[model samples]
Target: MSTQQPENTAPADRKVILVTGASSGIGAAIAARLVTEGHLVVAGARRTDRLRELATSTTEEAARSGGALEPVRLDVTDRADVAAFVQGARDRHGRVDVLINNAGVMPLSRLDSLLVDEWDRMIDVNVRGLLHGIAAALPVFTAQGSGHLVTVASIGAHEVVPTAAVYCGTKYAAWAITEGLRQEVDPSIRVTTISPGVVDSELAHTITEAGAAEAMRSYRAHAMGPDAIAAAVSYALAQPADIDVNEIVVRPARQR
Candidate 1:
C-alpha cells in the first residue's frame, strides 16, 4: 500500500470563523476585526443588505490584510436556517474553526409595562438563538476534534437591574448555557462567553417602554463603542488552542 501525504497545504495562519448577527454593532465589529487579522469570516444576519455592505467594505481591507469576509442570511432562532448557515460555511471553507454566537436583542421594560412581546423576543433571540448556534456547530467541532464557541452575552448576565429583568434573565441563561457546554464538550473544544457593559449599538433603539427608554438614555450616556467588545473577542480568539479563555467582561471606565 502506498502512503499518501495530506493534500491540502494552505498556510495554517488563518482560521475559518463564523459570526452571527453581523449586520451591525459588536457582531459587525468582530467580523471586521477578524477579517482584518487574516481570518476568513463568514458573517450572517437577518439584514442581508447590511451583510453585503459589510462584505463590500471588507473586500478592500482584505487586499491589505490577506483575509476576507463572506455574507449569509441567517436568523439564529430558526433551527434549519442556522444549520444551513453552518453547513454552507463548511461547504465553502472546508471546516468551521470557530462559531461566534453574537446575535442578541435587548428591549428593556419594567414589570409593570408588561411588554410581553418584547420579553418573548428576548428569550427567542438571546436564549434560543444561542442554543441554535451551539446545536449547529457542536457536531462539527466534535468531528474535527478542535473548535471554539464564542458567546456574546452582556453584563446583564451578571446582575439584574430595574426595567431589565426579562433581558437579564435571558443573558443569565446564556452565561449558564455556555458554561454548561464548556463542561460537557471535549477538552479540545473551547467555549468562551463575553459579557459587555453598555456599548453604543442599535440594541438601545429597540427599546419602546417609556420609563426604560428614558433610563437607557442616561445609562448609555457614556457607553463604550462596539469596537471595544470586538477587541476582547480578538484577544480570546488569538490565544493558543491549549489556553481557553473562559470568560471576558468588558465595560467602560466611567460606567459604574
Candidate 2:
C-alpha cells in the first residue's frame, strides 16, 4: 500500500511590479506576461493611447485568469513622472516588489553620420531613464527592506557593432550602473540584469541613419523574439526570494 502525497508548490503572494516602456515590444511583453502570472503589474510608457490599449487588453486577459492590471502614463525620461509613479504604485499595492527598467532607444548611427542628437536621445532614455527608475524605486525598497530591480540592457553592451558604438556605450553605462545599484542595495533586494540579443520588435525602427538602419536589417534578421526575454524575466522573479540573479544574458544561439 502507498500513501498519496501532495505536491509542494510555492505560495502565490501577489507581488507588485512596475514595468516601464511597456507600450510595445519587450516591455509590453514582459508586462503582459507578468499580469498573466497573477502579479499586480504597473505598466507605464510615454504613449498613453498605446499604454491604454495594452492595459485594457492585459486586464481582460488577466480577468480570464482571475487577475487585473494597473496602468499609468509615464515618460521615463521625466524624473518627476518616475517618482510619482513609484509613489502611486506603493499607494495602491502597499509595497513595491519589482521594478523592470525596460525603456530604451536604439537609434543606431555611425560616428561618421554624426547623429549626435540620436546619440543623446539614446543616452537619455537607455541610461538616464534607467537611473531615474532606480532613484524612484530604491527608496521604496529601502523602506520595505526588500525589493527587486530588473534592467533590460542589450547584447550590444557585450559586443560593439557597426553603427552601434554610441548606443552600445549607453548600454554599457546602463549595465555598469545597474550592477552598482545591486551591489549597494540590501541583501533582501534582488537585482536582475536581462541583456537580450536582437529581438523581434520595433527597436530597430528607431534607427534614423540610413546606413545604420540598413545595417540593422541584417541583425534583426537573426534577432530573437521578445518572449525569450519575457520568459527570462519571469524566471528571475520566480526564484527563491534570497537569490539575486545578478545577470541573465539571452542572446540568439546564432548570434556571434
Candidate 3:
C-alpha cells in the first residue's frame, strides 16, 4: 500500500534473477550482465561441468562487481529437474524476483523430411520447457507479490521461412503462450518476451539438416553478438516496475 524505497541491503536486496541455458550464448551473457549490474544471478544449464565453470567465473565477476551468482544444473525438458532447480534456487537465494526462460532447441528441416524426432525435440525443449519454467516460478511469484518472466523466442515466430516450419511453430507458440501468461497473471508479475533475429550463437549447430545448417551458418556469420540481446534484456529489467516492458525484438541492423 505504500510506495516505499526498500533499502538496498546486502546482496539479498538485489533481485534474485534466474536464467536458464546460461552456460553459453545469450543466457550466459545476460547472467553476466545482470551480475555486473549488482543483481544476484542464478545460472542454470543442463551441463553441471559448465555450470561449475560458470560459477567460478560468476564468483570472480561478483567479487569485482560486489554481487553474487549461484549456478545450478538444470534440464528444462525434465519436469522433475525444473521443479528441483526452482526449489533449490529459491532455497539458496531466499526469493526469486525474475526468471529468464532461455533454453530452446532449433533443429530445422523441411516438413517433407518429416523430421519427427527433431520436431519432438524442439517442442519438448522449447515449448514444454518454457511451460516448466512457468510452473516452477508462478507460485513463488504469487507469494512474493512481485516477479518477472523473461522469455527468449525468435523473429521467425512472427514470420515464416523455408525449412523452418516446426521451429517457427514452437517459437510462435512461445510468443503466444507468454502473452497469454502475461494477460492472466496479476499485475504484480511482469512478463516479457524477447524475439531475436540471427544473433550469433550455437543454435544452428543443433540443426540436423545439412543444407539447413549450412544456410543458418551463413546467416550466423553476419548475426549480432549475444551482448546486443543482453543489453536489451537489461534495459527491460531496469525499467520502473509499473512499466511492464512486455516484448522486445532484438535483431541485427542488417538482419531485415
Off by more than 4 A, model 1: 1-11
For each candidate, what is the lDDT? 0.93, 0.87, 0.87
**What is candidate 1's TM-score against the reference?**
0.95
Top candidate by TM-score = 1
Please report how far candidate 2 places residue 247 from its true position, in Å: 0.8
Clashing pairs in 3: none
lDDT of 2 by residue, 61-83 (tens): 67654445677899888999999
Ranking by TM-score: 1, 2, 3
Instruction: Please provide, for model 3 over 30-61, each residue's C-alpha lDDT reduced to its tens digit, 9 standing for 90 to 100.
Output: 98888877788888998778767767777756
Cα error of candidate 2 at position 242, Å: 1.1
- Poorest 10 consecutive residues by lDDT, candidate 1: 3-12
After superposition, the stretches of candidate 2 with alpha carbons farther than 4 Å from their true spots are 1-11
Q: What are the RMSD figures for all models against the true structure?
A: 6.2, 5.2, 5.9
lDDT accuracy of residue 127 in candidate 3 = 96
Q: Residue pairs in steric clash, candidate 2?
A: none
